[model samples]
Target: MVPEAEFTSYYGRPIVKPSPWEADIPAYLFAGGLAAGSSLIAAGADVTGRPVLRRAGRLAALGALSISMAALVHDLGKPSRFTNMLRTAKPTSPMSVGTWILSMYGPFAGLAAAAEVTSLLPEQVRSRGPLRLVGLLGRPAGLVAAVCAPPVAAYTAVLLSDTATPSWHSAYKELPFVFVGSASAAAAGVGMIAAPTHETGPVRRMAAAGALLELAMEQRMERSMGVTAEPLHHGKAGRLMRAAKVLTAAGAAGTLVAGRSRALAAASGAALVLGSACTRFGVFEAGQESAKDPKYTVVPQRERLEREGPVRYQP
Candidate 1:
């Protein structure tokens, strides 16, 4: 049985201080992942000429990207000092690289989303020369963004991984898969809600891939952290992840047979959405839970400290 415990810092070093950033930071991370996934779905629809899905996916991507930008800026320690983020790009540093990627991808994605909207307009409206010009130029932008977007989506996991945040850093492999799956699910959810489900073949495929990867990573993550993984396998994270896996599996399997019928599509979509959101929240909660525990921090530190004994004073 677990002993009654009081919270203490990790090795007496702060495990977490309330991040000074506003809610927008986390909100934006979710939104941005959604945008990246949606854009990829939209691109797939564009190739398949499923204008309904294409348009809806594009719009969702754009709206989410815009919101993400706002949230990211708001999260900057010194919003005014944001430019300093550009000073360098270190592979070991996820944030620095992420900032650069976002800088390049955001506008291009916005433009791509805008171009997709033209496909939905009346021919007369879409015929406007300037809009046509924008559409032509934006086409490449969308493709570029989509190809690049997956990394951007994955980078969030890396960002959190490098931090002292519990479970996040140690569970690096699993975290990226989690984000990837969640992003894909989010994209499918938007497509199912706004577009005709009959043509959501691409979305369904993405959902299948997402669900598979998430479940696999989660299992591996659980096994990877013999001791540290305790927080993830217990409490809210475990419960939520368990629920997510069940829902995601059910939803993906349903999609395999959910042909044309709108009802089946909607239900599957909802399940996927719930699963994805739970994954994100579970991850966040798990990190916090792990951080709050002394055992998680102390045990790891003690191992490290033992490996390298305390510094000796020079007489």
Candidate 2:
């Protein structure tokens, strides 16, 4: 019968514990997904006889996946416990799915990179048939990873939404789009940096799509939040989103103007990369902000418990 506001903080703790995940984890996730997608795109381009674009795509996939895997392991509660994620597939848990997705993605990406780096190796070290075989087999790894990447990138949104994180759960529809956009931008950035200007057309196109999508979703998320939106209005989340918008805009504009200038394309690519990072940071910070305020968690749950009754643990 009493008001829930009277009980502030969890166990008298003023701050909600941010997930054990470090700041790098989300960025890594973004980068990894983008890489995987790029690899698939590269393969497609190569098959279609777009040799220059193909190389760029492969490079992007490799570099992005490397950073993503590193960040992922670094975020584990017990880095040694990483294997447990693959112990079994649990549809109810996105983390478990992500683990397996990463598991398959790692080796596949490594092999593909080795295939692409034939020139980087010494004459003796340069592999031909076997390496090409690996490339052929591993070529799909990026797209394969891409299939799982969206879930890996956005499932965190669901995870936090289900928890006490403020507007995150309420804005579930927009989370996937936000993550997808960020991932695409990150991959396109890598492509722009590694490939020649003539080959970066796809990267530019993908980055523009991503930037526009993220900007639209973010604006909508802000407007849709109502009371829960306040977390995004102040502090780090606000700053990050604001910065992301500006950077995304700059990158998009630069990509349009870069034409065949590899250097200009590279700069635009860099801007997109920064923009993606900012978006990840902003989302995480927003979750933290939602968790920090007692009202955000308490009010909603209190309403649910009152209307539907406290969930009984039968087991």
Candidate 3:
């Protein structure tokens, strides 16, 4: 019997060009998610009367957003290139939508964080009219940031999955869930680290919920992706993903017992943040790797064609 012909593309070159993005893109993704999640946590803390948690979350939101914007600008190679994206909004374009989201989110997050800073000023300065005004505006600004948070956390997944990259495109259905969950875990970690143990009940619950959701979504995505998922399971991507899973799981479990000890809470929180970062980087690497291998492209197309048959054109 004749052996099946091996799938090859022009001396084994990649069938699709990998995205030119480097580490900056993944960093952007993680920071953006963290910013979004932190904003949400800040809002929650505000409502629950947890001053420390609220302050930390607001500061983190602005700081993370700044990092995210910096990374995106660096990846674009010019600040002007990013601004150009704002000239016209394209509803159909993920990049355009995401840019707009960032624009809206940045001002609110900044205002919220500025308010927090004003509150930290010396009593005399904070009691002054200008600082007092800023402090008064903080809650509303933080609320607005919370309102904008979900899209910020989830848009990067849509942006990544909108591309032709096999792993990213194939896993589009689950990527958003994974991203949002990771964001939640990271934000909860920040709250846990900064808030008093008595005020961390909600944060611990968020950590456990987010970790579980992220882990579940990742598994489901990989299982559904078939051959395209191979990149996520091997190489540097695999190692990072494994680390993420371990850290996230351990952090979630730790939350259950970390209530009594500030040190344990801080360690658990750090693990969750690191795990979230690893998850983003792992996903980024997997997409890049899938784009580099011809088989990831060919096998999926072949399987689809076999299932759907050839397209017929009408004269």
Candidate 4:
């Protein structure tokens, strides 16, 4: 019997070109999710009268967003390239929509953080005109950021899945959930780390909920993706994914019994943050690896064709 033929591409090159993005892109993805999650936490804390948690969440949102934008600009090799994306709006384009979301979110997040900072000013300075105005606007700004948070957290997944990359495209159904959950967990981590232990009840709940959602979505994605999921289970991507699962699970469990111990809360918070980062990096690497291997691209097409049969042209 003849052996099944091996799939090969021209000159042994990848069937699909891997994205030119570097490590900065993954950092950008992680930071963006962190910012979105933090904004939501901040808004919730504000409504619930958790001043310490509010301040921490707002500050973390702004800081993470700044890092995210900077990483994106650095990856693009020019700040102008980012701004250029804003010159036109394309409803069908995920990149365009994501850019617009970031543009709207940044100012609100910054304003919220700035308002939070005004409280840090000396009493006399804080009581002054401009600072007082900023402080007064804080609630509104934070609310706006919260309103935009879900889209910001999920848009990166949309952007990735919209790409031609086999792993990302194949996992589109669950990628957004994974990203949003990761964002929430990371944001909850920030609150746990920075807020008073007494004020962390909501944050702990959020952490548990987010971690569970992320874990479930990721498992579903892998199961549904078939061969495309292989990249997520091997090499550097596999290592990162394994670390992410362990850390996220540990962090969620720790939050259940963290109680009033600041050390335990902080440690658990750190684990969640690290786990979220690992997840982003792992997903990014898996997509890159999948794109590099022709089998990932060609086999999926072949299977789809086999399952659906060939398209017929109409007269």
| Clash count, one per candidate | 0, 0, 0, 0
Off by over 4 Å in 4: none
Of 1 and 2, which scores higher on lDDT? Answer: 1
User: Please, what are the lDDT tens digits per residue for candidate 2 over residues 148-246?
Assistant: 445545555555555545667767767777777777776777678777877677778887888888788878877766667777767988898788889
- Cα error, residue 35 of model 1, in Å, equals 1.2
How large is the C-alpha RMSD of every model relative to the true structure? 3.9, 3.9, 1.1, 0.9
Best by TM-score: 4
Q: Where does candidate 3 stray beyond 4 Å?
A: none
lDDT, each prediction:
0.78, 0.71, 0.95, 0.96
Pitting candidate 1 against candidate 4, the one with the higher TM-score is 4
Candidate 4 per-residue C-alpha lDDT over 1-315 given as tens digits, one digit per residue, 9 for 90 to 100: 999978789999998999999999899999999999999999999999999999999999999999999999998899999999999999999999999999999999999999999999899999999899999999999999999999999999999999999999999999999999999999999899999998999999999999999999999999999999999999999999999999999999999999999999999999999999999999999999999999899988999999999988999
TM-score-wise, the better of 2 and 4 is 4
Reference-based TM-score, model 2: 0.82
Rank the models by lDDT, top first.
4, 3, 1, 2
Worst 10 residues of 3 by lDDT: 5-14
* Cα shift from native, residue 222, model 1 (Å): 1.4
Q: lDDT winner among the candidates?
A: 4
